[model samples]
Target: MSAPGAGPALVLASSSPRRRELLARIDVAPARVASPDIDETPLPGELPRDYALRLAEQKARAIVRGEGELVLAGDTCVAPGRRILQQASDADMNRRFLELLSGRRHRVYSAVSLIDADGVQRSKCSENIVKFKPLHADEIAAYVASGEGLGKAGGYAIQGRAEALILWMSGSHSAIMGLPLYETRLLLKQAGYPIG
Candidate 1:
């Protein structure tokens, strides 16, 4: 493992390929990639924004030993009103999530947190509005059968096959993918990481 402050090495606390790809886009090459296992059950009356931030912080803290390494973590949630729509683990759940988001505008919240070697934690939240086209029964079934939404939030991947269903999107594309590049860059810079 790379030592802390060894040319700004980062430890990414997530297993999401999308997030990993997003980090790569910003030229961040993590020295260690650790996925934090935590209870993601939302608390009673927890708003989506609060839930996202809490999860992000928890993830970063879970993987840290207070050694002062730069730890990065993030969480993304799809919310229609106060309801949070998470990744569908099965076909039925994907179908129901798609039915609910079809032809409607929903909010995507992504929270990013960074814990520096000094144990100082900083977090930022990014929100985006996405409008999806009405989906036909066949389209939904086909998409579900393709299994692309199996592990994606809101039962779709904005950067994958589901891109066809998006009518409009307002905000950073990287936010929808689970990391906001501008915000992430800011956090990394604050943590003393050099970004070209």
Candidate 2:
């Protein structure tokens, strides 16, 4: 295993453009990107926080790698109460998600996992609370038609048109967007990546 701060090579095990953009914010680019194919279905009775962590770690583990490569992966889950919401795959699902968020507060759990060159792994989770405005039927319908909610956890993209409907949010915006910058940087730094 590379010693702490030994600057091992880095690989990203995710296909998320948002994560790419966020990594650039810290001026650390991965040497390569790998798309790990894995089933993301929530386990029966699995809580959102645990699911997020498991997915992140599994993605990192799923990546095929060479020696001296550190693989990074992340997952984000939206949970209201104990119910974990699925990505809105259709307009109907989007509408239903919006209805669930209307005048309500929910938690977003974002987890980042890193598998170091020596196969040692570490992970961290960012938890945030997001509140939405009481959405009316017309706006919900219009937003659902916009299609921004599709494939997004909680059926809304805060960086897109959904911003207008947010009442308040307390958490890492990067995490909500898909990856947590603060935690990601910390993990990388400890794993020996110079975030210059």
* Collision pairs in model 1: 68-117
Model 1 weakest lDDT span, ten residues long: 1-10
Candidate 2 Cα lDDT to native: 0.91
Q: What TM-score goes with each of the models?
A: 0.95, 0.94
Q: What overall lDDT goes with each candidate model?
A: 0.88, 0.91
Supply candidate 1's per-residue lDDT for 74. Answer: 96
Residue-by-residue lDDT tens digits, candidate 1, 1-196: 2244556568899998788888878667788899899999899999998999999999998995535468999999999889998888899999999999999999999999999867889999999999999999999999999999998888888888889889999998999988988999999888887776
- Ten contiguous residues minimizing lDDT sum, candidate 2: 1-10
Q: Over the stretch 1-196, how does candidate 2's per-residue lDDT look in tens digits?
A: 3234447778899998888888888887787899999999999999999999999999999998789989999999899998999688999999999999899999999999999888899999999999999999999999999889999999999899998999999999999999999999899888877774
Best by lDDT: 2
Error of 2 at 10 (Å): 1.7
RMSDs, each prediction?
Answer: 2.1, 3.2
